[model samples]
Target chain A: MRNTFRASMALVHTTLGLVTGWVLFAIALSGSLSVFRQEISLWARPELSVTPSDPLLVDLHALNWLSQHAGHAGAWYLTAANERSPAATALWPDAKGHYVQRMLDPSTGSPDGIRDTLGGEFFYRFHFELQLPYPWGRLLAGVAALALLVGLISGIIIHRRILADFFTFRLSRGQRSWLDLHNLLGVAALPFHLIISFTGAITLGTMLLPWTTLVLYPHDITASYADLNPALYSRPASGHPGHLAPLLPMLKEAELHFRGTGLEQIYVFNPSDRSSIVTVVAGNAHTVSTTSDVITFDGPSGKILKEHIERRPVIRAYIFLYGLHVARFAPAMTRWLYFLSGLALATVIGSGMHLWCLKRLRRPGHRGHRIVFRLNVGILAGTPLAFSAFFIGNRIFPATMPDRAFYEVACVFATWGITLLYALLRRSNHAWPELLGADAVACLSVALMGPLWHGGYITAVSMTALALSVSFTLGTLHTTRKVHT
Target chain B: MTWISLLFAQVAIGFLLFGSERGKRIFFEGQLTRERQNFLKFCGTTSLCFSLLLQLFAVREPVLDIIQWIMGIAIEIIVAALLCALWEKEHNRFFRAASQHLRK
Candidate 1:
């Protein structure tokens, strides 16, 4: 019985690992990059890398401008500013009631840049949705996460010496090295991998478990939410004629009411309405979750009335879980750690696939090994190269170009597809070095071109590229020498 | 009393069951085996007793639906085995199916 169980566990691990290795790697790599998604956006568009945007300062200027411009319109929404840009953005209903965001310089109240530059939002959107039209992309990502969970379980079951595997890594042994690296990373971060996988799965559980609602409550999911918490769906009315009270005063009211330290977001509902309320949501930064307790104040009177910490437990739990998954409360250091860990996860997936190819190449009957090899090259090598190309396109592409984002995405895929074709056609012995060399060259070229293309110059970006290219060139030389020997 | 408490408790029970099962198999495989078995039996019976209580408390049907679905199958199997064992005690003339077949 024990032997049978052991055999079954091995089978489960091998099968699950092979099936989801690439997808897992991609998800991890993207997620890791997503931790610095905003910073990378700044990197991509070096043109916008100047002066950090402060919300308080931006809000003051934006409110004054919005008050003057929004004559007879509904309440204006100032997009909370941060370290990304100095422009303040406001969204308000036009004569047709459609929402439009206008970007204004906080100090001057003059228009600066277009509101929809897709800077940081590109990463935020790509993290879950991959820029694919709603539901489908996010659903795909969620399903991949579930697959990753299964892979994690199967990996634990299959590994015979988890502890021994923890400390072992082979260098200069080709496939053995790949397998060792994969095993080492997987075992080292097992707990985090498991929690991250499960939470990520549950984060999308509502979408995944739509059938649960169908079977249990056919008519009303809304009722389920209400049973959990009535305040979950409440929103303030619009079109009220009232000036918003100062943010600091409302923030004080929230701190006094919720008994929390900092404020997260201030939602001004019905800013134009005389009865409109300003809701300040207090943020407890020390906690893993930012399920804020809100204090709503009358916009005109500055009188605080409603204080809501959502009384229902289940609803609060769900909100907290969601917030934890988003990791909004994490400090910069913590985020960087998470990002590096995610990079290791990406390496695990890439190495696992590489291992499969290596194992197959040793035996004679594995005909599809070549295909797997090409795919690993295309995905792992091509993704980072594509990423660098996006930066290049962001700089080099004419600003007047229609749909600059669409063109940038096109450039990325074009470079990536070409790299894959070149990898497949090139000799197997030379392919690894060649592909790495090509990517390094592309990165370096783009890095150098940044100054030529855009007036803004980043010494750090250029230096990083130079270092990467030197390493890749040295690696290429070493590989060629080994092959000849 | 809070619904979040119940959710945490459910997760805790799952972990506890897994941990106890592992402990019994690994650390205490000798004299304490019977005690471990009895503990598991008691947990099973207590879970059955609280089935009704669980249904009454959590307002959401989906939550109840899932809980009942998992627990109902477990409870049914346990109750059936207990009944079968009691019936075997009463019917001394009748041999169990597997034993009678093996005798042939």
Candidate 2:
């Protein structure tokens, strides 16, 4: 009975891994890149690469800019310049209710001529949203995470000699080697894998598992949000125009109230009217909680209207999980560590897919096997290539072109689509090396483009590109050698 | 400094854990006895615990420190494994020469 149970678990593990492994690889890889989202955004917009200045001083400039550009808007969100992101950002709702964002020079309140691009936010959002509309993308991501969790659990159940295999790795043994590596990487960082996956799932729990919210707030989901985050709740705008009070004092008061935590975001509601309220949110860099402690003030009076501190244990735990998954509170070194582990996780997923293909290759002439092999090559190799294309597009595209961000994203999908089509049409053995070699060249070009055009030898983006180039070059060499063998 | 110390500690743990048979043949040029293996395991575990404590003390934030320690260990393990795999002959020669020198 025990043996049967183990066999069933192994079957489930293999099935779950094979089914969700490709998507999980894409998600993990994007997420790993997203760890440096701010850095990547800085890379994309070279104008914002200046060293960070005092946010309080920058806020005055930002407010001046907003008064000219966004004063007539319904509401405004001003994010102060920080160590990670030096550019002051402002977002305001237009007449159409769509929020438009602009990057501002920290010193001069004018709009920085940064090219419109999705930037690193594409990866961060794509990790969870998958570029799909609304809750469906989140639900899909949550399901994929759930599958990953199940795969991990079942993988543990099947590995009888988990401890013995911890130090056992056999190189150049084909399928055996792949299995060994999959086990080694998986077991080495099992805690991180489990924590990241579980927390990721829980972070989307309200959307994925809506039963609890349904029970609590059957008629009104907005009410639930209001209860959880009362500061975000809006009051009707009064028609009477009122003179705005000085924001620096209210910001100072908020900084004092939050024990000197840096201000992350300032939200002004009904900014042009008498009932205007300003919300100052404390930054999350010092704590393992993504939900900022919020202090709201009356815009005209500058009186503290509401203070929302997340003190409930459950809510705090949820916030911690969210923070842990996002790693927004992490320092630079720790953030790099997170990025490395995320890459390791991505490797684990890729190797599992490779192992599956290797096993299928042992039995030739299977149509389904060939298709899986093609897909594995297309996705694993194609994603990095498409990402490189996106970066290249960012550099090459005209900065002032209309709807440029849309084209940037379109370039990514177009490259990815073309690569996938080529992979599916060509045989697996031919597809792998060609795509990998092309990806290597693409990466190398991106690395060189910085120095060639911008005259900077070692910007963060170029360094990242160089690293990726080396990695892809090695991958190309490995594939060529494997094919020759 | 903290990351460097954590990395060294992880490498030490990896070396001790793999000192027994497979890694010994590949990298160390010496076999470990069963008693020595047990001792190495204990030492590795203790070193890992010590590293975690050091990380906690260094960062002073429980959640962030724990994550940093885990990621640091993971990177160290990958590096150690890759080093062993890619430079096995070089490692073997170095260890063999060191052993000969020690004997002299």
Candidate 3:
């Protein structure tokens, strides 16, 4: 009976690991890169590499720019530059009802002339959104997370000698080595994998299971959100033109009210009207809560209006999980740990896929095995190459090109599609080394070109490029050795 | 300071585990008695628990602090394991050379 149970669990674990491993790898890889999203953004726009000023000074610059460019709009949203990001940014609805964003110089209070690109936001959004239509991408990601959770649980159940295997790793034994690596990586950081998957699922809980919200709110998610976060509730615009007071004093007051917590966002509702309201939301730097404590002010008078602090235990618990999933509050060392953990998880998935292929390859003339092997090679090796191509495109593309950001994204998919095509056409033994070698060359080119173009030897962009080059070079060498052996 | 201490503690735990009979037999040509094995296991567990406790007190927020500790410890373990693996390879090479010299 115990053997039967173990057999069933092994089957289940293998099936789920093979099925969802690719998707999980994509999610984990992109999510790991997104951990350094702000830094990547800074690297992308070289003009913004200057030292960040005080938050208040950055906020003032952003607000001044907004007043000059978007004062006639319905509302304005300003995000102050922080330690990680050097450019203060603003977003507002234009006359045609289209939302527009402008990157402001923190010191000059004017728009910076950096080239338009998606920057690191592509990976950040792709991690969950998957570049698909609304809700569906997030739903798919949630399902992937669920699959990962199941695989983790069943994997633990099937590994009979979990503790004994923890310290056992035998290299160069082919299948045995692969299995040992899979077990070691999966079991060593099992807790982190479990927490990350669970929180990731919960982060999209509302989107994945809208029935709960439907049953609770019945008709209005907006109202539900306002109910959950009272500070989001705002009165209708009075529609009478009124002179607005400066935001500096209100910001100071809100900071004091929040006990010196950094202010993250400033939202101005009905900016040109009498019923204007300015809301200041606290940053998520010191706590495990993504929900910001907010203080709203009467815009014209600059008087304190309403303050909303999270008090409910249930909401606080949700906030904690949300913060864990997003990891916006982590310090530098902790963030690096998260990145490394994510990379390890990605390796676990990749190794599982390889193991599945190995088990199938033992059978001769298996068409499905070849297809799976090719697809794995394409995806596992193609993604990093695609990322490098995207960065290269960002540099080579003209700064003034229309819809340049979209083209940057197009460049990524195009490179990825070509890689998949090449993988399908060529044999696995040849495709692996060639693609990895190309990736190494691409990464090294980026590193070498950064100094010539950006006039810097050790900037963040160059350093990242150099690191990626070394990694890809090592990957290429490993693949060559594996093929030769 | 917390991260440094956590690193040292985790590496110590890794060494203790790898120094036991089971790990040594797998990685190195060595053996240990039952008592010494049990002692090493106990020490590793106690040091791990104490390191976690130190992490808890290092940060103010409960959930974030726990998450930080988990990531920190996981990274340290990975590093320590890799280091042990390298050390095992070196030890095997050294012993192989000594045996060859004795035979000659």
Candidate DockQ scores, in order: 0.01, 0.42, 0.46
Q: By TM-score, is 1 or 3 better? A: 3
| Alpha carbon lDDT of each predicted model | 0.60, 0.81, 0.80
What lDDT tens digits, residue by residue, belong to model 1 across residues A223-279? 775444333234556544566666556655566776644455555666666666666
- Residue-level lDDT of model 2, residues B1-104, one tens digit each, is 28655765775667565754556666545666777777777777777777777777874677677777777777676667666666765665687999999999
What value does the lDDT take at residue A245 in candidate 3?
92
Cα lDDT tens digits, model 1, B9-97, are 34433323323433333234333555665665466445534644564565544432333333333223323333333443444335465
Off by over 4 Å in 2: A1-3, A452-458, B1-4, B24-31, B87-104
In what order do the candidates fall by lDDT, top score first?
Answer: 2, 3, 1
DockQ of 2: 0.42
Residue pairs in clash, model 1? A240-A272, A240-A273, A241-A272, A241-A273, A241-A274
Ten consecutive residues with minimal summed lDDT in candidate 3 chain A?
Answer: A452-461
Q: Write the per-residue lDDT of candidate 2 for residues A97-209, one digit (tens) a residue.
A: 88777777888877657677777888999999888999888988998999899988998998998876666666667788888889889988898999989998998887778
Q: Which stretches of candidate 1 lie over 4 Å from their true place?
A: A1-3, A44-54, A63-79, A82-111, A114-116, A212-217, A220-263, A266-284, A295-306, A310-324, A365-367, A399-402, A424-430, A445-485, B1-104
Fnat, model by model in order, equals 0.00, 0.42, 0.33
| lDDT, candidate 3, A1-485, per-residue tens | 23698788888888887787878898998999898887766666666546746878888878877777778788888876676776777789999989876667778777658666667788899999888999889998998898898889999999998876666666556898788878878887888899889998888888778897788888777878887778865888887897579888998888787775578788998888898989988877576678568888999999888899888898889988888877888877677778888988998999899889988898897998899999989988888888888888888888778778889889988999999989988999889999989988888877775573554323656766788778878878988898898
